[model samples]
Target chain A: MTALTSAVTAPGVLGRSRALVRPALKEAVGRMHPWVGEMAAYSFGWCEVGGGPAVASGGKGVRQALAVLGAEAAGAPGRAGVPAAVAVELVHTFSLLHDDIMDGDAARRRRPTVWKAYGTGPAVLAGDGLFALAVETLAGTSAGPAALRLLSASLGDLVRGQADDLLFATRPWAGARRVRPGEYLAMAEHKTGALLGCSAALGAVLGGAPPAVVTGLDRAGRHLGVAFQIVDDVLGIWGDPEVTGKPVHGDLREGKKTYPVLAALDAPSPATAHLVTVLESAGDPAVAAALIDEAGGRTAALAEARRHVAAAEAALAGLPIPAGAADDLRSLLDFLVCRDL
Target chain B: MTALTSAVTAPGVLGRSRALVRPALKEAVGRMHPWVGEMAAYSFGWCEVGGGPAVASGGKGVRQALAVLGAEAAGAPGRAGVPAAVAVELVHTFSLLHDDIMDGDAARRRRPTVWKAYGTGPAVLAGDGLFALAVETLAGTSAGPAALRLLSASLGDLVRGQADDLLFATRPWAGARRVRPGEYLAMAEHKTGALLGCSAALGAVLGGAPPAVVTGLDRAGRHLGVAFQIVDDVLGIWGDPEVTGKPVHGDLREGKKTYPVLAALDAPSPATAHLVTVLESAGDPAVAAALIDEAGGRTAALAEARRHVAAAEAALAGLPIPAGAADDLRSLLDFLVCRDL
Candidate 1:
């Protein structure tokens, strides 16, 4: 049967693929120092390495699985490639840890953020340590010179993008009054998409996939990240607390210029104007929910997200993926952009 | 003449070597984008690319010279190794830029620090940019895998050391009473020694020197860094402001627990006890300086610095250095720890 048919008919392929990748991640992480392994286990919602009960829960681990699957899809699945997968996860964790600090967020994964638990200095060090470890892992990989360069360059982009985002947050006046959609897309690409690109690219680099396949996978990941960020922004305002671990309309209250806000800002409406006004003040749930709904902001943002998802799918269409891999990728993309509380 | 003899005979060798390294640094820096080049020129006291006069007078550029001369001492003195030399300097500058911010230092190299000039955000981004650029350069080099690993590992050590230092600083319990000399040495290793070791080893890496020789250079660099740091601590309390660019007795006033301070704390005399008491209190320069003087802290610190300098010299002994290079190295070592101001 075709991958699409298997995905539609059986649907177990997704779970099975996830099962395949999860062990690789666990085995790879087990190699870290006992303390780092414990911290990581806690970070990932695996068994409590900290003497707590063995609670198993986490954000999808989709990025890491994607890295493993990406390598497999390109026809190189082995013990050699697992470290790159670990590296990707480390980079992802580093970003999340630092982002929590930068955003002054207190909770993560149903627990206190690293900074809240360990204090800011150690948290920063932990993040930095993880980042160092990530790059260091690549050195031992058989991925060779070109891959190292690509990884380094992608990291540079990730940090640069983050710098831009932080700068925008701290000094909005420095940015243009109305950022073009292209600029928003670029920002998303850097801040969110770059690591996903690294995930795909690192996989392909390790797998020794042809350049064309690598490029396609990279494009696929970029679009997937863009779609993911848009949906994330939507969920930020409209998501349920149970699902997101964040209060509804939190981003709106915080005056975040998410895609929805940017989209609404671009096309002026009375509702958008109201949003702009209330944005300066914190939005209570009733007012925020109404403002988001009345402006058709969530709907517009969903549509935008779908567009990027479709683009991502189209990009993946060109890749010469292995058996069952395509279905897993498709399912992963679907899971990334489509859940609600 | 031997390096020791020339040190007493001709101090100009060190000065001339410094001159050679300066223009090479300027040329390499000039190749970056106009904005970065401009910032760097202002930082390095070079002329603006658009034919204007120099922005500010440059400092000693001692780190870059160390890298170049160290490489030359290993016997490959050509431009082939210059990229590594340039890269080491960039890494040093990146560290200094961030360190200045972290330390809340206002002046560096007789000019406003990057943080002071461009605000914290830009300064951080610029430092990050330099770091990325340095890695990119090293990755692009023809240097072997071992060399890249060494450089990357050094950078990691630098971060780890820095993280530990910051953690030590912020921990409320880590004051004079709690801080230890070992901790101070560890901080110095990370903050100052790691890069110096990298600088010395880069030459051997480029020269394809035997592993033993490289290890010897590394050991030499570490001892030299310790000696340099001890002298720096001495200067912080007793050096002239015209040379050090900060007030005399600055470390005492800042309540910094340097090696000397920690030593004093270990076995307190009456005056040492009083100095510690003042440091524990307001850290007023007038009171602290008087107490430090009464304690004969300057003489004690100088004696300690002399011991380390001797150790550094001993570490360099027996290495089959190129003719005249050893003498120059010895001279530089003496000048480093023997600076009166």
Candidate 2:
């Protein structure tokens, strides 16, 4: 294997892709109206809340990296994937802005979210502006029509996922049956996997790849996305606050119906009953975590994530891509499912 | 002049166009996910909030009419413009859904707004779904790219306008200078005119019109849009509630910074001072309306609306459309400016 094919951490791949994608992403955001642009910049961690100087704190550019890898796997230059990369990143950021408002999340990446710092009205408008800008940016690319269609369809899926999430979160837990694992996985596929699948498919289409290659990348990305969300559920319960830049057990505190919590509730054990009791009241995070662990929820979730990672890797095996590209994808899959934070 | 060249009432033209466009618009909205489709259908007054039977209560379909007229003027069948018409109407409904949420509006068209009936999260997702579906629908059209670019750019303008409206509404009235009429007009242009211009441009482009014809139609649509907004402002203050389906002096009751309100503030009259004082506190709608009328705000706004209508009509004069098409446009322009509701 080449040096580029060697196992690399998630942050390492993110850093390399961020170096290439951030400039174009920034430029695309800069095209928004001045006030909207400022809010978007703040949301992206490119600047402070009041807009003084750059902060450079942002989420890992996993989607953009996937775009670049997908394009390269299709034998196109990474630079040729810049527009699709930027488009996906913008859509991701747009969802974050609106989701923060809808979820009533006050902070992200250890800083006050846009809605918390500015106001809900401005945050909503800024999100809408980013969405429009995403379409506008893709419309200027050589594969404009195809990319627009993919992005638009992905957006619909994202909205549907969000709607389902909201409905599931508000269900009457006292009398309601435990949400099935299949239902949770389906929602995750829509909420998290759809955009990732679009990211890969868009890059491949823009790179002039064959339909088979696009379909393969999309399936691989979807599996990887599900695995990523499962890992996120794990981290939400037990992650180190310092490393995650989020409060430990934050999702538990918010009473979120994440994968691990759902799994624990669905488990046929006395510990599951205790976990449910704790979740229904103001139980301490440590006790709840212990109950969930004793019920085998943590192990079950981790195992499911591994299964998805394996499936993702299998999906890429038949694709006519370079060995190095496949190796990088496998590394990403591993990093995603195994990350500590 | 032929019979088609004769002046027509606003309802006459609206009724005709609504018959032509509503079927296509309904089908397009019906293509969304079932839940989202239900919310959209409710918002459009096509069904009840939880979805049982159809109850069609909707806007006048003015933008869709303008789109179809634009294409027909460019010598294409009106049916050929259905996709663009549906696209523009979906975008308009999307704005209404989100704007109603941002503005905390409880009711629209004498019924509960989407956010009020179905909850804010579902309303937002439904709006987003409609937006994505708009782009998806347009992507299937022959004029997909150009139409997409126009709609995307118009959406950015609309968001900017909404942002400014929120900023203006939140400004402290104690020491701040009065908002100028120019600023209000500019905001209205962004809020209303951009999409109308895009509708005309997209239709003309779709119909294979020359560049100059498209430009002419865009300019005309913009002017007509401004006039439409001005009339809406007038209706907000003094129109009969039975006709407008809103409370009399609704804008005054809500302290909206509309065209007439801004003009009243700028007028050099003792009523202007008193109106500002009343606006700063809990003012009676009847007194506020009287003060605005006495200050000549109503007259000034009416004059401005007429000027825009004249400009809109003049723009059509130089276009290479059939006389009947030009007459229809002029009739629509006149109807828009002179409407009672």
- In candidate 2, the residue pairs with backbone N, CA or C atoms under 3 Å apart (3 or more residues apart, or in different chains) clash, namely none
Best by DockQ: 2
Q: How does model 2 score by TM-score?
A: 0.91
| TM-score per model over all chains | 0.80, 0.91
DockQ of each: 0.25, 0.59
lDDT of 2 by residue, B1-341 (tens): 33334444445656776788788888877777788899998887789967988665788788887788778888997666778888888999999999998899998887888889987767777888888888888877768577788888888889878887887787643345667888877788888988888887777778878888888988888887788888899989988888777788878888788888788878888888788788888578898889889988899899988888778778888999977667777777766665432
True contacts kept of 1: 0.22
In candidate 2, residue A120 scores what lDDT?
75
Query: Candidate 2: interface RMSD in Å?
Result: 1.5
Best by lDDT: 2
> In model 1, which runs have C-alpha deviations exceeding 4 angstroms?
A1-59, A110-123, A170-176, A268-300, A338-341, B1-59, B100-127, B167-183, B267-304, B314-317, B324-328
Give every collision pair in model 1: B3-B327
